[model samples]
Target: MSDIEDKKNSLIEKMGSEIITLAHGSGGKAMQKLIDQVILGFFGQPNQGPLEDQAIFDLSAYPNHSIALTTDSYVVTPLQFPGSSIGHLAVNGTVNDISVSGAIPLYLTCGLILEEGLLFKELIEVIADMAEAAEQAKVKIVTGDTKVVDRGSCDKLFINTAGVGVVNNSLNIRIPNIEVGDKVIINGDIGDHGVAILAARGELDLQTTITSDCQPLNGLIQTLLAEGIPIKAMRDVTRGGLATVLNEYAQGVNLGVLIQEAQIPMKTEVRGVCEVLGLDPLYLANEGKLAAVVPAEYADKAVEIMSKHPAGQNSCIVAEIVEDHAGRVVMQSDFGGKRVVDMLVGEQLPRIC
Candidate 1:
């Protein structure tokens, strides 16, 4: 959008082929031009500086704040999925990790691995989405590197990202802060991401109208923190899903977790898919979901505030920390029977970011 970005965009036009080749990875004009035009063009030069081996940030603005850092790699198959792509997932995933630590996501670093003969147009599209996701999360992509591998050496694409954030020096959200009678609240329905990925793979020959709830939650979480919700501990319901998260929390403080099945929200289609496949929705992955444990006194306020946000319209208290059955997670099913919800032994869905 600036004169510098305008100049950078021209480099993409200088590449030799519409598709990537080994030459693009060579230390030559084509590679430099490609990186500059793609990264700088969409992300804009961060901190008004040139790209270098490392990114620099001025700490003066964040004085009295503690720094939080996180990193993750994305290898989601089918690079482009129904509600989001690997690019968007990479950005949101890293941002969520930093945010769950009660930090304000500020900057990110992107590392890309591309297979030979990958489509040039596809690369631009992914980079654009990553930039858009970063902007939505109010963060910047500061630095990145790209490598091209031989065909069949790697998937079509793989992305690695690192995030940096600033947290209030006084705020420390951790499992140690959780206590008995604390209500467990979730932002919205679960299992959409896992089911969506399963459908995308077409390995099961399934059909559905489900879409991944892939969006940034920094704004939603920050709003509660700003309003003094007093969240005890919070975690993004990612890879291992809500069951795993609660298990971790319960074991962390050696307490019991009781979640009512009726209160755990899920879309009808997602539930139906899980039922037909004999899969438990409790362990289904989510990209844009989070579980926050707040005291009973603030539970109403927490749900009230969360439901107002677009990312948390179905927010509600699904469970609570208890003293009975310490060191384990229990669930009250719709049939009025109690059962133990154990940790996932093996991954239910793979490459599901």
Candidate 2:
């Protein structure tokens, strides 16, 4: 190996501990070690030898393109989890946002905040996982920033992503376009993301095989659009899960929504976790799923088109828009009882995304 390579490895060996230190954030050799062994090693510059402060894109390649811009932050603890990492969540979270707005995600910019005393190995794994996710979503992380703070000042790590996409103006899907008699369909099981994070914390001392369903939904949504399915509104089931999304649509349109408990899809393990914790799955969070409002006639077609894709194989119709009880969402239990699915008073799982 070259003298510099031997020296870098020697530095890593002499660190003694796998955890980060104040020196790693001091803009010195230790900091360079952290950057070389963690960040740049995973997300390497393609055409340049080193990273620059900014990235330039040539939008002129796409003539008459409508652009969509979105930014999101992810602060999930246990940066590495069963199915995803904070980096993976950051990319998918931003891409999904632009996708729901009827746009094709193109590029992204990432900003990371690292806390001292975190494991250098963990940071490396997070960035590598993120690179894989961006590749899968067909988006590029063209620019990024990183900052390290003293221990306890921040979580182990937090990621912020700003995404840009090209929107097809011909579709023009928006919430206001929702009409009475519209049907609500969800892409997959709910509560997986929240429950996964909860389980990773190990506070509940529960053991199950449930992993976070954190993934990019743009591909599935694009399939629906390509099939010419009529969509009125679409919301990814995230922070407040299905109930919160339903409430948003109902209140936005000043209409009522009725959902069937039996029809709502959820993983068996997720349901069991909620039952034991006395938490309502409807109010939980999801990462890789979405709920959409489509015309009644096109609901079945939408489900069919979505089912053909692996990401949306479990898509199903769960609710319908009604005019009677305007601005409210009611759920019918499988036992034939009805109750209001109200907005959550507070977050069920903080730092989930």
Candidate 3:
């Protein structure tokens, strides 16, 4: 076995606990083990073994057509924010999730829980926003369900969306495609959605005019694919942020990832809030960003295509897969020091989505 494999095995052996804890949910070592031993170990499939942000199944030999399906729920508090509202977030989140899986999101089903005494005008506004976002994303709300609950039983609104899209081809983007030398690319600034919500809720002291980066990314992914760029896998870094997503990739591929903190895209205002709040931007949440693992040879082409698109204009190569530090994400700080960038165990800003 390689040196790194030996080391990782030894580390796992030494973790002497069988009981569950909140740290396991933190997206750190504890969570990693829980998923590896409990979830992935039992249910993982050959092609769908925890790689990619989503699973890709083969249908080439079966049916002539293939489909991609995904679901997501948005429970961001305050219902509305500076740049977008929970309505837009719910729709975009589901659309982007399916899009990054290399599918063309075609239809969505929305389920909403409305609290009693909700302002009728506000409900209409939210639906209007959802319609506008659906139009922009080129998807339709073909079906939906609505329910009303006591004022104290439910928040202002909670939205759950399920989406389906046709896979243009049988090629699946699984995480196992990530090799030792693949490049990591992020679409744009991180933590805008989380910080924006926090600011709107008066959770932060300082703020600038910044909006949530909530938007559909299917168009951007379509553009990238048309360019014939080789993307090993794709994921929208929403909850649990980029760090958690990278850690998920690392475990799936059994490879280590080293990212340069300097290369991560974060807006100045978001950075300020993270600093004041003592939160690592890596652990912060983002709504409209995506992480792509590309073959090293095609990294440049991928970045170029991404930069030309509106949602990915600031795309940059943040890191590369490595053989060492297996199942871990390490970051090279600006000060020339290295630190383990693990996932947050609990929600950093809960109800912010």
Candidate 4:
């Protein structure tokens, strides 16, 4: 391990805290350390394996099949956003988490936390959105739970979703599968969902046509998988955006990821919002976008495959893996300069799904 990593682990061990900070839920470096030292460590020597978004299990009797399961919670403020509701976000987020693991999402279970004063009409709309999204993704909401808290006990609503999917036995995609010479592909633009959610809050009185790029990606992922494009691994850029996803991939494989700033897909509106609010799009969140790592030989094919899908029409090759600077992400600027793109230090746009 690098000295920086050692120091981080030492700090985590030395710190005394029974309380959780928003950063602990930011899905960034601090959260990772918290999980490693507190959650996973408590379970005894954690598995020394490349981390994946979904847990995979084998079915011995069904030799041609395995299972992938993942869970996610959405608490994006303003429950109803420009392009999606919390309900839709919950279903799509959980489904994408499983889909990125090369799984075919089959079913989902939702748990809703409702504030007492929340309107039933609003609740109906959120559920309706979820139903449409589930149908669009070709996944079923097989089970669920609902609970109400005191008026001020919780926010308007929060949705938790757990998803189960079938993984093809032939697919062995994992983070460890990523290696030097691999190319990174992103499906669609980044930062749209985060910026759109912020705009919906009307805190800055910013006006723009940007809408959340929130949509289920199982169909798009299935299309890419069908092409047999030699995908090494995939990730949905959710809580911590493209930078976080690339950082995780680099750390997992102990390699460097070099991405070009000019090549990253971003909407002008998102860029504008970040500029006005002093936010970096790299560290923002995204709901509908995903990043895929594939062999150099399959890079173009991967982009082509994704571009053919509605959810992936804005796809592009964003980066490549390198052997130098192990466990770091380097972003090459248009001016021929490079800098390390580290994970968020604290929560950026809290409550963003």
Candidate 5:
């Protein structure tokens, strides 16, 4: 073997692995193993071993108060799609996730993975879009890393971002707060991101432009919180879509949820694409939107406050928490039939953000 090949083999042996696998993306035990053995072993600390969605550090002891840190990676195919691109999606996704936790996103670290032979112009455009989105979200990209892989070793481009945000004093959002009789509301139409990606890839024949619903939702959430709306829990509907998100909340609270088919807002184009593709809109992805649970008394007021914001203008009360059928998501069909919506067992669309 050549000297380079021998050296690469030696390095792989030392690392005890030669290639990556899909388990790295799974959120299950295999994913945890990969993180603990490879990722965390290399860079994580003892305090950060128990992985939560975001890292919580006691900044109060350090004189700066408390802080929340989160990181995410974007691997959506066809970086440029209708309404938004991977760049903006990355920023919005990270910012919204942090914001829903009652934090004000402050700074971001960007990491770019570029494939050899990828066009430089395209890369510039993506970065420019990311910069603009970050500006709108009121977050700064403070640091970053760049790496290029050989042709065929990587996708055209992928982005990883880590964000730091300060927790707001007045808000206390948590999953356990979701209770029976709590109203479930969505910021806007669902499934826009998935449909947009599908259409962009020519997977659907529909000609109409159904752009992605990708945008920073921090402003909308802040507006609601400012109005003193009591939010029990809030989560952005991204991968696995609304169905998976609701199922998670229901399971966490050991409660049942009932959603109205007529009340859920969805664009005609998106609905059409889903119908043609034999896809369930509920399982499709959305990047810019969120689902919030609030008490019945605060529901109307919350919807009013949400409607005033552009991002939440189309917001509607889609469902309600119930004591019956604990840990299940039941939907009232348009035909007056009740159906159960469960978590997505497998990937409906791979590499979809």
Candidate 6:
């Protein structure tokens, strides 16, 4: 049989019947057939150097900087959402994790798990999305791996990405660096990504036009660093949303995080949906938003710079690091009341990037 026929017979082996063959998982002929064609066709770039087991990056330019590495897996359901896709999350999620560490993102590595019955069309669409996202973020997909599984083993697809970035040693952005009286700032509105996913699922029969806020934030971070504003700590608000992120800072620094409910940014549609659904928007996940604690002296300057940037047009101070109520997160309600914002107990939304 031809090599193509062998791959079709082994890699795609009768979908529901022993779908995962040795040929597909054992680096056999079937899997190798896909390397040059499928993987390279989508991820190949000019001047990528010779193919090898790993990517080699010259760090001579980063003399006194530190290298930052982060990895994340994407299993977001409905693969394609209103404003983003699993592919976008796979790239941007990893990028933001590095950027939030006050690093300059450089390269990325992708690993994909493809089910036996997944359509090439859908796979190609996702690969294209990842490539486009990487290009836009000014990062390169230097190396990657692909594997196939049984028809029912995994959902249609899953993507794992590892990112590399460099951080200046002169800067110290960490939980320990967060000090009381520092101002907490957010780039823009929150809860859009979570709401968009819920609306896309069509499970609640809800109606709204909220789109995912997934985007790379490296540019914003670079802008802040360029201006010489010192950042106490930064975190990409994902999975647990802004409330959980704030609670982390509170617990990390053993200080109080006081956020005004009225000062938090949100769209009217998102707020209304959360109210109707009995869901607190603060706990809804965000993709593009970030919560930053900056020195009191540079708080306004940071906000001013962030406000002018594309990613932070709605920038505002939503919270303050305080000495009162140590190791706690307190929110002054919009209705003249105060409440403790605890860390999320269980998963509010699963498979959400």
Cα RMSD, each candidate: 2.8, 3.9, 17.3, 14.9, 11.4, 5.4
User: lDDT tens digits, residues 217-297, model 1?
Assistant: 899999999999888899999988899999999999999999999999999999999999999999999999999989999
Count steric clashes of candidate 6.
0
lDDT of 3 by residue, 1-353 (tens): 64323433443454423333345445578556644543333223345433444433334543554788888887788888979998788889999988888888887877767676565445545665776688789887655555556667777778898998877666577788889999999988888888888878975465668889998999998888888887888888988999999998999988999999899998888888788789888988888999999889999988888898999978999889999999999999999999998868888888876
Ranking by lDDT: 1, 6, 2, 4, 5, 3
Say which candidate scores most in lDDT. Answer: 1
Q: Residue-wise lDDT of candidate 4 within 65-152, one digit each (tens)?
A: 7878888888889989898878789889898999988888887877767676565446555665676687689887655555556667
Which residues of candidate 1, in runs, are more than 4 Å off?
Answer: 1-17, 46-49
Tell me the tens digit of each residue's lDDT in model 2 across 108-163: 99888888878765665677678788878999888887787898899788888999
Model 5 spans with C-alpha error above 4 angstroms: 1-65
Residue 112 lDDT, candidate 6, scale 0-100: 87
Which model, 3 or 5, shows the larger lDDT? 5
Q: Can you write out model 6's per-residue Cα lDDT over 1-353, one digit (the tens) per residue?
A: 64333433443332313333435655878677556655675577787768899988898899999999999999999899999999889999999999998899999999988887776556655776787788789998889888888878999899999999999898888989998889999999999999999999999999999999999999999999899988889999998899999999999989999999999999999999999999988899999999999988898999999999999989999999999999999999989899999999898888899
Q: Is candidate 2 or candidate 5 better by lDDT?
A: 2
Q: Give RMSD (Å) of candidate 2 vs. truth.
A: 3.9
Q: Model 6 off-target regions past 4 Å? A: 1-30
lDDT of candidate 5 over 1-353, digit per residue (tens): 64323433443455443333443344567446544443333234344344554433434533433577899999988989989999898899899989989787877877777776665446545665776688689887655555656778888889999988887665678999998999999998999888888878776465867888999998998888878888889899999999998998899999999989999899988887777778999999999889999999999889888988989978899999999999999999999999999999898888877
Identify the superior model by TM-score, candidate 2 or candidate 4. Answer: 2
Alpha-carbon lDDT, every model: 0.88, 0.85, 0.78, 0.80, 0.79, 0.87
